[model samples]
Target: MRTFAVLNQKGGVGKTTTAINLAHAMALRGHLVTAIDMDPQNHLTAGLGQETHPQVGIDEVLLAESDLQTTVIDARQNLQLVPAGTRLSEVEQGARGVKGGLLLANEIKKLERQDFVFIDCPPSSGILSMNAILAANEIIVPVSSDYLALHGMSRLMGILNHVEKRLHHKMTVWVALTRFHGRRRLANEVRDKLVNYFPGSVLKTPIREAVALAESPSYGQTIFEYQKRGNGSNDYSALADDLLHGRTR
Candidate 1:
C-alpha cells in the first residue's frame, strides 16, 4: 500500500477537498482506500457522509488507547475511514516530548493490505503534523492560483526537508494547483510559475475553481455523485487518473 499526506500549512487551499474526493475516487476505481483525518475539525468524517461518531478513531489509536484494527469504520463497500474526533488536540499533547514521534508509522503498518492511505493534516507544524510527515511515503501540496499561495508551498517544502532529515524518510513530493481559474491571466501566470519552480514535481491535472465542488460537501456527496458532467467531476477524475499513473510518469 502507498501512503500520502495531503498537507498545506495555509487554510482554504482545498487540502480537505482533495483528500475527500481522491479517497472516494480511488475507491470507485476498485482500490481499497482509507482516509485518516489528522485535523481536529473532523471534516473528513463529515465529507464521507458519516454523522455518528465511531467508538474508536485515530486519536485513540495514536495514543495507544485503541488498536488500529478496531479503529477503522467501513465508510463504503471499498472505502474505509479512520475517523477523527474533536479531542485530537488532547491526544497530540499527550504524546509530547516522546522519542520517535512517528506514532502514525507504527499504526499504519497494522493494516496489512490497502491500495492507498491519505492523511488530512492540520494547518500547523505541531506534533500532529509531524506524525503525518513521518508516516507518509509521499506528500501532495495543494496550492491555490494566487501569489500568496506560493509562499505556503515554499514553507511546506522546508518542513518536508526537516522530516526527511529527522525522521529519516525520503518523500516523493508533488505540487497540484487547486481552485484554478483558466480565464485569468494572473492565474495562468501563477500556474506557469509553479511549473517552472517545481519542474517535474508539478502535476498537469489542475482542479478548476467550480461552485459544484463547494456545494457538494453540504449534501455530503463528492462531485461525481453531485454532478457528473460538472468541471469539479471532470477535474477530480483527471486527478485520480494522474494519481494512479503517477509512479510511471
Candidate 2:
C-alpha cells in the first residue's frame, strides 16, 4: 500500500478535511483506501459519517490492545476507516518509551490488500503524530492560504527534518494548498511563496475556499457526495489524480 500521513502541526489547516475527502476521492476511483484517524479529536471518524467514539480504533492498535484488522470498519463503498476511539488521548501517557513511537508503524506493516492508506494526524507534534509520521511513506502537508498557516508550515518542516535524522527514515513530502482564493492578493502571495520554497513538491491543484468543502463535514459527507459539481469536489478529484499519477516530486 502507498501509505500517506495527512499531517499539520497547526490546527484548522485542512488536515482532517483533506484526509477525509482525499481518501474518499481515491476510493471513488475504484482504489481500496483505508483512512486512519490518528487525531484524538476523532474529526476524521465523525467526518466520514462513522461513530466518533468507536470501541475499537487506531488507539487500540497503537496501544497494542487490539489488532489493526479487527478495528477496521467500512466507511464507504471502497473506503475503510479506523476511528480514533475515545481513549485515544491516553496513548501519549500510556504508551511511553521508544517502543510507543513504532507501534503504528508495526501495525501498518501487517495490513493487507489496501491500495492506499491515509493517516489523519493530530495538530500537535505529540506521540500520536509521531506514530503517524513514522508509519507512512509519504506526508501530505495541507497549507491554508494565510500567514499563520505559512508559519505553521515552517515549524512542520523543521519537525520533519528532525524526525528524518532521528529515525533515519526519509519520507516523500508533498504540500497541498488548501482554502486558496484566486481573487485575493494575500492568497496569491502565499501560493507564490510555497511554489518558490517547495517547487515541485507543491501540488498543482489548489483546493479553493468553497462552502461545500466546509459544509460537507457537518453533514457527514465528502465534497463529491455533498456537491459533486462544486469546486471542492473538482479540486479534490484532481488532487487524487495528481498523487495517483506521480505528478508531485
Candidate 3:
C-alpha cells in the first residue's frame, strides 16, 4: 500500500478535510483506500459519519489491544476507516519511547492488499504524530492560505528534518494549499511563496475556500457526495489526479 500521513503541526489547516476527501476521492476512482484517524479529536471519524467512539480503533491498534483488520470499519464504498477511539488521548501517556513510535508502522504491515492508506494525524508533534510520521512513506502537509498558517511551516519543516535525520527514514513530502482564495492578494501571495519555497514539492491543485467543503462534514459526506459540481469537489478530484499521476509542481 502507498501510505500517506496527512499531517500538520498547526490545526485548522484542512488536514482532516484533506484526508477524508482525498482518500474518498481515490476510492471513487476504484482504489481500495483505508483512512486511519490518528488524531485524538476524532474529527476524521465524525467527518466520515462513522461512530466517534468505536470499541476498537487506531488507538487500540497502537496500544496493541486490537489488530488493524478487526478495527477497520467501512466508511464509504471503497474507503475503509479506523476510527479514533475514546482513549486515544491516553496513548501518549501509555505508549512511550521508540517502540511506541513504531507501533503504527508495525500495524501497517498487515494492510499489504490496500491500494492506499491515509493517516489523519494530530495537530501536535506528540507520540501519535510521531507514529504517523514513522509509518508513512509520504507526508502531505495542508498549508492554509493565511499568514499564521504559513508561518508555522518553518517549525514543521524543522520537525520533519529532525525526524528524517534521527530515524534515517526519508519520506516524499508534498505541500498542498488549502482554503485558498484566488482573488485575494494575501492568498495569492501565500501561494507564490509556497511555490517558490517548495518548488516541485507543491501540488498543482489548491483547495479553494468553499461552503460545500465545510458543510459536507456536518452531513457526514464528502464534497463529491454533497455537491459534485462545486469547486471543493473539483479541487479535490484534481488533487487525487495529481497524486495518482505523481504530478506535483
Candidate 4:
C-alpha cells in the first residue's frame, strides 16, 4: 500500500481539503483507502463527516493503548478513517524521546488491509507531523498560488530533506497548486515558479478556486458528494489519476 502524507506546515493552505477529496477519489477508484487524521484539531476527521470515535482514535493508537484496526471507522464505501480527538494535542505534547517519532509507524505495521493511506498532518513541525513523516512513503503537498506559499515550500523542503536523511528513505513527493485562478497574472506566475522549481513533480491539473470546496466540509461531504459538476470535483478526480499514473512514476 502507498502511504501518502498530505502535509504543509503553513496553515490554511488546503491540506485537509486535499486529503479529504483525494482519499475519496482513491476510494472511488476501488482502492481500500484509510485517512489518518494526525492534526490535533481533527479537521480531517470532521471534514470526512465523522465525530471523534467514542472508543478509540489516533491518540489511543499512538499511545499504544489501541491498534489501528480497532480504532478505524468506516467513513465511506471503501474509505476508512482513524479520527483525531481533543486529546491529540496532549498526545502531541507527550511525544518525546526516541520512541515518539516512530509511534505512528509502529501502529501502522498492524494495518495490512489498506491499499492506499492518506495521512492528514497538522500545520506545524511537531511530533504529530513527525509521526506522519515516519509513517509515510509518499507525500502530497497542497499549496496555494502565492509568493508566501513558496516560502512555506522552502521550509517544508528542508524538513523533508532532514527526515529523508534520518529515515534513510527517499519519499515520492508531488505538488498540487490549490485556489488557482486561471486568469490571474500572479497565480500564473506562481504556477510557473512551481513548475520551474519542482519540474515533473507538479501536477498538471490545478484546483480552481471554488465555493463548493469550502462548502463541502461544512455539510460533511466530499466535493464529489456535495457538488458533482463543479470544477473542484473534476480537478480532484484528475489529481487522483495523476498520482496513480502520471507523476508518481
| Most accurate candidate by TM-score | 3
Instruction: Tell me how far the alpha carbon of residue 139 in candidate 3 is from the true structure, in angstroms, after superposition.
Output: 0.4
**Against the true structure, what is each candidate's TM-score?**
0.95, 0.96, 0.97, 0.96
Residue pairs in collision within model 4: none
Q: Can you tell me which runs of candidate 4 are displaced by over 4 Å?
A: 52-55
| Residue lDDT tens for model 2, 104-173 | 9999998899999999998888889888888999999999999998888888999999989988979999
**What lDDT does candidate 2 reach at residue 58?**
81
Give all candidate RMSDs, comma-separated: 1.7, 1.4, 1.2, 1.5
**Model 2 C-alpha lDDT versus the unseen true structure:** 0.89
Q: In lDDT terms, which candidate is top?
A: 3
Task: Give candidate 1 misplaced runs (Cα > 4 Å).
Answer: 97-100, 247-249
Evaluate residue 174 in candidate 3 and report its C-alpha lDDT on the 0 to 100 scale.
Answer: 91
Judge candidate 2 at residue 233 and give its lDDT: 93
Clashing pairs in 2: none
Q: Give the TM-score of candidate 3.
A: 0.97
